[model samples]
Target chain A: MSTPSSEQEVHEHGVTEAVISYPQFLWKALGVATDGNALFYVWMTALTAVWLVGINAFAHQIVQGQGLTAMTDHVSWGMYIGNFTFAVGLAAGAVMMVIPAYLYHDEDMHDVVIVGEILAIAAVAVALAFVNVDIGRIDRLWHIIPFIGRFNFPVSMLTWDIIVLPGYFLINLHVVGYLLYMRFLGRKPNPKWYIPVVLLSIVWAVSIHTVTAFLYSGLGGRPFWNSAILAPRFVVSAFVSGPAFIVLALQIVRRFSDFYVGHKPIVTLINILRITAVVNLFLVGAEVFTEFYTGGSHVAAAEYLYFGLHGKNALVPWIWTAVVCNVVAAGIFLTVDPRKNLWIIDVACVMTLFGLWVEKGLGLIVPGFVPSTLHEVVEYLPNALEWKISLGIWALGLIIFTLGLKIAVAVFTGTMHVDAAHDAGEV
Target chain B: MSDPSRRTMLKGAGATLGAAAFARAVAPITEWTNDLSVEGFLQKHYKELTVEDMSAVLARIERETEEQYGAKVSVEDVRPTPGVQFAYALNLSVCIGCRRCAKACHEENNHDRATNNSYIRVLEMTNGSLNLEHGTVTYDHAVPAPGKFYMPVQCHQCDNAPCVRVCPVEATWKESDGIVVVDYDWCIGCRYCEAACPYHARRFNWSKPEIPADEINPDQAYLSNRIRPQGVMEKCTFCLHRTRRGKLPACLEACPTGARVFGNLADPDSEIRWVLENKRVFVLKEDLGTQPRFFYFFDE
Candidate 1:
């Protein structure tokens, strides 16, 4: 995130001479020459270990029924689905960066942009993997294919999701392969593949989360999701969170690696994050007004989300926390002094990312299902297993992202040309 | 960023030409095609069933049932099942403020073991009131204890259902004997039908249905009783398995006061026909013109 943005600001215009920068302590993370794959391997091992332990421990309880889970019928899609939707949203957001950096000549975002696409792909895969884990039947995954046994393409928003996800998968596949090839050959990417797919990928990135929004909003009966605002909420949240997600990754990398991605990219990222976060902030306001202004089922749901209702308090705290965090973080991001202050920017990024994740993941889903779709107020609380699973998935995404950035950092700086040098190096 | 849901309702019901070749066998004249130019995969909604295709689809259904749910189910094509004609007439007036129908549906449909979801919902309404706007069909609280007449609603199985009308991908459709069924495998779980349905009869299996194998009903139809895949849309099939067996729907049998009347609407002499003729019969959201075969009437 910071890597590409700072790298991007330098040579957005005409090609200039390549000048190597002194190895400032801030520039070097992960001690110049550390093994990212080795780190990734250990992290991967930890993930596998946690997954096996949790499954083995809870095997009997799951078999007995979902009593072991914090979820009852009320909060049906609690932790597992929450994590699933969040990961999917992040995947959508990552592509938001991937498309423009390579496709268009957004040279500002040149360095480390491919990492976004890679992260996006891996994120979706991880989201889907969590879904399968939650269901505990990896085999039934094939039923989604229309030709395989049966696949009801009509009437099922999930069916649309099934189509769009893999389509996005294939599109990302080509993009990733192109980037990987470029990285391996130690040259710049060809536009032939990039140009033709660029427009579709942009629209497809929007479609991924918009479709996800529709998955909930299309349900007219679910008062929580039936808002005209759900689609917009998703789009804005994605935009606001996407940049911050990138920045957070960059900060984590900066703290650990020797990827001399300077402060310029971080500032550029901060500027974008501020604009989007403020826009997202306004949308959130409009959503609150539209929902409460109407004073109907949608209003009731909004109230349920913001404040407890009917002797139930499920997501009000999380929702308000997300709202406050977003508002304050956006405020901090927009303030000139704090926006420039690297530490303040990092704090804002963390807040925005956490807020958006809670909003899109937990807030969007739980309220929509609150008082139950069947109108039963079966509030969900994630059990240890649910938490373990949720934590496990989040950890997995971070690990994937971390490993991806490390490779990206190494490539762009050494074999990895400085973000400034890479585009001109090709030219 | 804000688009009006690129997914809108498009009735591809007009593509009966190029599609005629696909189902070149069974009764095409009367079954599926009715002067509609349905486009895309929606065009492949259903071709006329040949004896072979029916057998094939039925066989496929059984195999699917076995493969998906590990239940050796019998899927009878049952082109309008014999002997006891099938009809559903809801006595909206006679329906007490009880939810016996919902309970019955939960038991008979073999709903997911975890949630115990049902195909039936009793809209608790006021007496002599027709506006469903104020009605609350989803009641988690204990029911039949207040000032409300419960109208148990399920798939209307309409002659011109909005759910069937606007399905861009025809994963669901009305049968020859006036029943609507969803092919769980063919269904993408897009929930288009759930939205288009005026009665809100359709449900989506957000998670793979968890049904105890021993509790599974072996006599399943391709469109009914089979455990649905996660991410597909499904709804009441009028209990196809039992209806074809010359038996009553679980809801009809469950009513404590026999408030429901089940008989073939096609047969003029059926008791349901008698009720439809004698009583002031009505259907949910009649102005939608769904022409639901499920009629509602009050007791005299």
Candidate 2:
């Protein structure tokens, strides 16, 4: 559990900030992404390949129309919408690190919070891409803009989503973008530029997921989503999955590059994950009990989700798997000291991420359509086309995250740091 | 002149290959442009378009429909008249599960042939049960098989319609005459309205809807049914094309048992108003307060 000390110790021992030249910093960082070992090239090429495949599939979809996918009249939304929901949660979950770092002034989380912010930007971008692809008419997207096309603001939750998601993306981009640019220039970041935005982003973070939850919850027809507890459940699960993702991502950053992510931040993150996972589990139980105990028309979706309805049990096994994974992951964190054994932390993090992905994605969306309003049980499963498109979107997000992380790591490690005293100052 | 280095040759080759690949990728778009004109692409939003613009858009749609489906169809822009509120009533006791009304609507509205995307779904329920949870929409048996009753459902055109409220682009809305319509061209095909409707009334055009030239409904309205393009949401407009023009809805006219009734609810002497006044009329999911203009009554 002892902190791994090396470059961090030296920096702390003497506050001798490495002076960097802005132009040289850019050149070095650019070179780092381009001039890499074979493995890095392979990784980048693989993602690009997948991304290109996805682009091909999406182009085919646009030409052929959405009919190529399994989405039917019964199930209007398929994999694309489900992935959008999960990505929004990932974006909102960035607030978990932000709240601790900025509000409580947790020094351990201060440096790591920017990593989460970058993640938020990537997640939001992917979520928006999903919307653009999923929609029947991308050409008509301008209709959602105010004054140009009649933007149904305030009333429509989807419009709220259109506003908040991009708004959040901009906020995170500004905060992370400014902080990194300042770091690259070897200058101190002014709090005035980012402080107010950081606070505003915290609220925007919670609102994005809450508004998304309302997109479902506000539906008068779908009883499965029309619950008072839905919003809170979304927020809680988001906190668990978002931080768990960052915890694993930080480990990758530490391993792959010279980024010095201390053990203290990981420990703090595990503590946060443990608490949120437990609360999320409790909320799941609460929803299950309320649905099963009441035994009303609304319970039709729950019955289909947990047990089979009309001999169709498509989601039954999936929901059960989610329940087991989340409960066991939370249990592991509670009992085992992940700080002592890093394996437990890694395993727990993967389990919670997978568990929440299923719980929120398919487990939330598909069942709402099952036992349709007229009470018809037509199960939905995403076809191959949807998977290809989804994989492409994910690959695109990862590519962005990888490149951003590369530049960020170079800046943080002072590999781009120059003898500013001799160079042509901060460009 | 020296031969190009390997790196230089690869760069040139890559650029050439990229251009070829880009051409291949854009081929479909070029073909689509042939069918969908640049004028169609630049068509203004339904609310923004002038009378001249709307007429031009309608002409383009008619021409395109003729070109694609090979049917000379009339696509008219039907406007709601003031002081005329539309309403519908279904007699649960008399409705046979024949689904003839649904079939007639399919043809009248020009629904897709492959999926038979009808807005109306007739649910057969066991007697003594009003619980929708137990209703079976896919009952393949004969009409009103012994112990079951039929209830055909469609857009209720609620005064405070959730579907209209949830449309992010205002693509769908309730008209002054109480008929909720979707501007097929304006809709982005997001399906938020589909998710919002409790009745599961809204249907999305998942792909380009196919219909034979002979089977295509020549009488089409812009707001009601004009063979919606791929990737937009459509629902029952209470047959606005017909009803707003002082004609009975196709479903009502096609119903054999006189179970379906359509009238201007704004008229005090209308059959729908009479049903509401005399019969024990009720709406589905009344507790949600959608206040649907469509009513159901047991023919006592």
Off by over 4 Å in 1: A1-48, A51-76, A95-106, A130-137, A146-156, A336-340, A372-374, A415-427, B1-77, B81-87, B97-148, B158-173, B182-235, B254-256, B267-295, B298-300
What DockQ class does candidate 1 belong to?
incorrect
Top-TM-score candidate index: 2
Each candidate structure's count of clashing pairs = 48, 1
True contacts kept of each: 0.01, 0.76
Off by over 4 Å in 2: A1-31, A417-427, B1-33
Q: Candidate 1 at A365: error in angstroms?
A: 1.7
Give the per-residue Cα lDDT of candidate 1 at A416: 42
lDDT of 1 by residue, A1-427 (tens): 5688656665552223222322321144333323333464466557545644444433433333334566543354667777777777777777556555655556656665665676776777767766655542232345456674345465656667777777776787677655654554355677786656755777887888887787777654566676778787777677777777777776666666676554545566666677778888788788788778888544666677788877787687888888888988988888856434778777877888889878877787777666543344556657787776566556656655655566566655565433454345442
What TM-score does each prediction get for chain A alone? 0.80, 0.92
lDDT of each: 0.64, 0.86
lDDT (C-alpha) at residue A112 in model 2: 79
- Candidates' interface RMSDs, in order? 15.6, 1.7
Give the TM-scores of the predictions, in the order they appear: 0.71, 0.93
What is the two-chain DockQ of model 2?
0.61
